[model samples]
Target: MSFFSRMPLFVLLIGVAGLAMLVPAAYAAATAWYEIARSFLFSSVLMLVLTALLGAATAGGRRPGPHGRSVLATMLGVLGVLPIALGLPLAMVLPDTGIFNAWWEMVSCLTTTGASLYAADMLAPPIHLWRALVGWLGGLFILVSAVAVLSPMKVGGFEILSSPYGRSERFRPLPESADPRNQPQFFLGLGADRTTPSARAMRVLRDVGPYYAGLTLALWVILLLAGDPGLVALCRALGTLSTSGISPVAGSVGVHSGVLGEVVVAFFMIFALTRRFWPGGGELRATETLRTDPELRLGLTVVVLVALVLFLRHFFTSFEQEIAASNVATGVLISLRNAAVAAWGGFFNALSFLTTTGWNSVDWQGARSWSGLESPGLLLAGLAIMGGGVATTAGGVKLLRVYALARQSERELERVVHPTSVSGGGRMARRLRSEGAYLAFIFFMLFALSIAVTVLLVSIRPIEFDTAVILSVSALTNTGPLAGTIHLTPSFESTAGFASNPWEGWSGLAALPKTVLAGAMIVGRLETLAILALVTPDFWRR
Candidate 1:
């Protein structure tokens, strides 16, 4: 147990991923699918053997200390190299997907992008479970890394709230009497302690893993009661908690759980909007609570305003036409029902996209029918770009950054009206309005630049501009399902057919573009700043 626990992060992850295959193996065995079962069993054994060899060689070395760079590199490996290792069984089982496609699919799920090359009916139930399980593990990895690694390093979105990068208290020089190499490190951050990186990571998993798994299990049971089949419910629950948006079926359109299921899922989506939902994620200020969280406020505001616009866009037009075509009371009742449906759809869909989960409300079709408009694909993309709260499963620019930018903009406007006005929100508020805002703006701009660069790369495939844009945004936001919702503009021939879906579009792409999108997903998951930090010479010299 000690040797296993002391294994390097990548080795540990590889082993866990190997063990994860047993789930599908067991399922396949129970269902009399021995070929598939053998494939998984063989892969699991191979991975464990590899893990044991690697762990034995490296476990006794100078124990990994609190080196942020190591953690960052492990994360990159988890997103990139680990997927290649994890994809073997998948490639064996899904013969149509070559090793490269299998690797790409695992990359998508591990980064919580949840993009698939196969149609829903193409893979068996066990395969879908594999994808969802991988995604769930990926989500847990993000959470643990966010608090244990990124917070101390002052990278990720924590830069907005932390002292400037490389200047954090955690990075201070060691005392003269103490040999830095011999002493344990103690840094102030969420879940920080006097321990090695691997120990710290395991501690966080122990603390946070249950809540993560329990939430998924609870949601799964509730979804089953709501009418979804067992496997379907389990996948949905895993997808929801992980914000992976993966499923055995299609989007909510493919769900049998109906409006009630959608409602329940939507309620659970709130977890992505704020880190406060988790242990050790509460506000630094005793006075602040979830109700007062700026991220939550900004997220709710965005959802409500976007939903309202979506509802109103077709409400008046559809209402007037219906009233003119029908008798008075009948027209009023029907129009009211349509309005209600549209509102609910807008609200649900808006929340889904904002969290980067990419769930299309089942009533989204009804909303479109009532509003007399195609799905607002561009608008959904915009919401995804806004993303969810910091240190959560969802990805994008993040709500805290957005909130900071908004607060700073408001302050700037006030300054414009009164030259001598002082920002008066207290120390934390002042920090947020000043340094926080500046950092947030920088990240937002970097995020935008990432999208532009990704778009350029994808466009090189000779893909249409609209499709490239959607693909870029989806990949960079870690919101893969967003690519499937491209019905907003009619100009592209890609969206012309009823059978069109993201899988078809993505699968047809040349290898280069697909690889580029995969890289973008890694960038989105790790955030551009962390990647940049890795390349800087000073990071390695230390």
Candidate 2:
């Protein structure tokens, strides 16, 4: 299939996504949210007109099947376009800011990269809702894309999602065909065989989608029951499971300000992180798979270590001051519980955000307290860098890649000592030694490059290096909080150090820097290699 042929479908899909804004816009209008409604309607009209024109122009062209390059292009293009489209409404409704700043904000949200230009407290309710909605939609788009598109292409570390376990189910192969160009014919031949490879691929999506949607719905009900407003509850439910931390208000899980609410959100965040626990059908159980999965074990181990560090810090430090500032109180026993809660909250937050879901409900004001524990917040930041399972909607270096590197190092040490003894792992481990090393290296390099670019861009404004790094990492990884940087007492402008003249920083920035950051956010969410492949001429050669 030709690349150009798919352009219309892509445009139409984006327009459909844009048009979805009307539902919320209608609600806002009924409730007298004029600005919000106006933004939505105007954006919708613009998108509808543009999409219609594009669709008409390209409508009768040859349709394209799912090919590697086309899928990569579509995914990257969607990631780039959605923010640009949504930014129109934001820019129109927001204070007179340059389109670059507006694009930055929308890109942050839609990519589920939770970097925010405005402080949470300063944002109007409708604008906040729009941010949350964009995050939610972006997350769902990525999840669906992971299964339907990226999986078959074997890019973006999705190869891990197809891991073969000891008891993994086996399937029959497709029937042989005489014609080499008859690829579709071979696929059709497999339809006669119930256990064919193509059938298995389809089954994976069918099984995973329902599980994802079901968990999301369950979280939604729980949030509503926990006293969240209907709209806010819906947004969080979608955003949280998808790991998109775009919140209706600045403070994510902390926004609700209820113990039960926090607990509920914390639990859900943990659930999203543990791929093995997610309900799905297969001979292989995720828990059983986890027993041998070094990455999952390592990630969990990191969480445990972080929790202990935080617990001791809370027990010995000036705990009252930190807790009091956030309006959270705990007795000796409750303090222990709070520590556990905060630990789990931080752990899951790291897990989810690294996975690129960016959900958070923990108080940012209390970040300094965590910092005393030898900077556990930094540890979480490191975890976000490590990332979660493959084919999951998370971002960062990914735990599996880290595990592969560790395994490779272990083998290298053995080789140094004996030079002849055979390694004990399987074919997969051997493959990791060869192909996986290169991929892992590229992944980490890109991850580091993203952080560097984000830090440089964020530093242009009046912010500290540490805070800027945290924000950059969080946004690049699509994670929400940057450790102790969340301050709710003063408005976000003051807390973020942007009160006096935020735009003044822009005067120093050329157009290229702004475009680069927006590009970085998209690439980060999509994974750098995927973006590279999409733009590479060789990728389209096939």
lDDT of 1 by residue, 1-542 (tens): 56655778888888898899999999989988899899999999999999889888996787776766787778788899999877899888876567888898899999999887777876777888899999999999998888776666667777676654443343346576887668856465553344666777788788899999989989999998989999999989999999999988865633598889999999999999988887654322211666788888889999999989987886887888888889889988988888888888899999999988888888888777665777788899899999998889999989888888888999989999998987897766877888889877778778888989998987786788887888888999999889878842322322212222344467667777889999999999988857556544435643
What is the per-residue lDDT of model 2 for residues 90-177, given as tens digits with 9 covering 90 to 100?
A: 7777646556667777777777766566655666667777777777667656655554555444556644323332122334466564
Candidate 2 residue runs with Cα over 4 Å from true position: 1-7, 65-69, 159-211, 252-257, 271-295, 316-376, 416-418, 453-468, 483-513, 530-541
Clashes of 1: 0
Best by TM-score: 1
The 0-to-1 C-alpha lDDT of every candidate, in the order given, reads: 0.81, 0.60
- Number of clashing residue pairs, candidate 2: 14
- Model 2 CA lDDT for position 201: 35
Please give the TM-score that candidate 2 achieves against the real structure: 0.75
Q: Which stretches of model 1 miss by more than 4 angstroms?
A: 164-194, 251-254, 281-287, 488-503, 531-542
lDDT: worst 10-residue window of model 2: 186-195
Q: What is candidate 2's local distance difference test score?
A: 0.60
lDDT for 385 in candidate 1 is 93
